[model samples]
Target: MLVRPSLTPQGAALALAQWWELAGLEIPDLSKVRGGNPETGLTASTIVQSQEPNLTPARLVQGSHHPQVALVQAHRLAAACTSMDALYKALDAFEGCRLKANARTTVFADGRQGASIMVIGDVPGREDDEAGKPFLGPAGGLLDKMLGSIGLYRATNCYMTNLVPWRPPGDRSPTAEEIALCRPFVVRHIELAAPKAILMVGGLTGQTLLNSTDGIMKLRSQTLDYRLGLDAQGASTYAQCVFAPTYLLNRPIEKAAAWQDLKRFAQKISAMGIAI
Candidate 1:
């Protein structure tokens, strides 16, 4: 049997510092990053998000590094898109995200554009990347059924897309920098679609959208405001988190809880007088 060695604390810290430098981020105070408790065992990659004003990834994409500069370009392009088609074109043309190079294709939103509800998923999975669409394979089938339960069919009343359009290599979670670069496009998508409600699937989706460190268990089944900007208008939408279909597949026992969340989601939509 091949035995793997674990990284020593010093090695781990060095690696994390290097990553921060490469990403054009300053290494935050390690003690504070660990919440002043080394036993907390939080790696830089796994740090809980803070409630800082700059928590929004879209807000971080400018004048920092090459990646951030690309993010600025993304914002300029995204702001120019007045329609979904234009946004799609922009995504296809954009080359800021490194994931784009290795991905089979750029996965875009699926379903009707003007749908009253939009479902935002985490990064695309392996199957989705191959198909160049969000929510493909078993997970997608499960999502379709889940949506159908609430009379929100993608074919008719719901629009669906992933937060990051391109799939990461090995279907790994997207890095913060990658998400930051892609966020401008996502913001424009939400604006143009103008969904009354947004169903955020997966922990990463909820965390990124709400700018909270809370996990799915804490964030689910509640109607929270997903603010678009901090300006005078304070444009926002009713958003809720639910278990990803992929998660449910791995933990079927949690289906009961997922169902309850779905029911609450449906109730919230109805209370808001959304026909779907």
Candidate 2:
């Protein structure tokens, strides 16, 4: 397993500046960053200026004192990627998210790229990380069956990707910070794919993308619009939430609810003149 050392506070300040320069953005006051206490004002910037600088963007990404710095870096890197290949390369090279340290491989998206329906899951599991793809193992088989039932096939009409590319250690749930760090890339992915409708599988994915506090049961019953980005170039799409295959595998009784959600999603797709 590869290990990366965490940056000291002074190292973090210097590294952040380098990252900003690399991203071609004017370096802002570090103290004013999201995680920093605004009460301190520009004190963080003052301290950064006083520190001896010696870090490159590549090495700087090993770790950071402020998580928000990493999040900003992720956004910058993801935005710089203009194509899917560029995005994948950027994500593979990105070292901001600590999850990458212990991950076997970077699990990227799979299935059709320009498919009308895009499936977004929470995070990669151990099987996904090992295979370097999303949706694998027995759960993946179930997903295939579920999609088949609705006439949505991953290889043909469906595109698939996970919110987080790297799997958490021991298959643990990803933390909020980890999700935030990877969010930009995922959003950019959706924009590039330009799918008319998105199927958000799993509660975490549904909650995060929809910005809802409701569980999968409540979330699945409603169809909502997901904004692609904050910029003018962004657009909106119809989003449907559904229970994850893995979740259904454990709770077989919930399969009925999952079926209902899939039926509703399919109906909406047809209503939009999208052929499944």
Minimal lDDT window, size 10, model 1:
1-10
lDDT of each structure?
0.74, 0.76
- Superposed by TM-score, candidate 2 places the C-alpha of residue 253 at a distance from the truth, in angstroms, of 0.3
Runs in model 2 lying further than 4 Å from the true structure? 1-30, 34-65, 232-234
Instruction: Give the per-residue lDDT of model 1 (tens digit) for 48-100.
Output: 22221352334333232344235445666677787888788878877767888
Clashes of 2: 0
Which regions of candidate 1 deviate over 4 angstroms?
A: 1-65
Worst 10 residues of 2 by lDDT: 1-10
Sum up the clashes in candidate 1.
Answer: 0
Q: How many residue pairs clash in each candidate?
A: 0, 0
Task: Identify the candidate with maximal TM-score.
Answer: 2
Candidate 2: C-alpha RMSD to true structure equals 8.9
Q: What is the lDDT of candidate 2?
A: 0.76
Task: Quote each prediction's TM-score.
Answer: 0.76, 0.80
CA shift of 226, model 1, Å: 1.9
TM for candidate 1 is 0.76
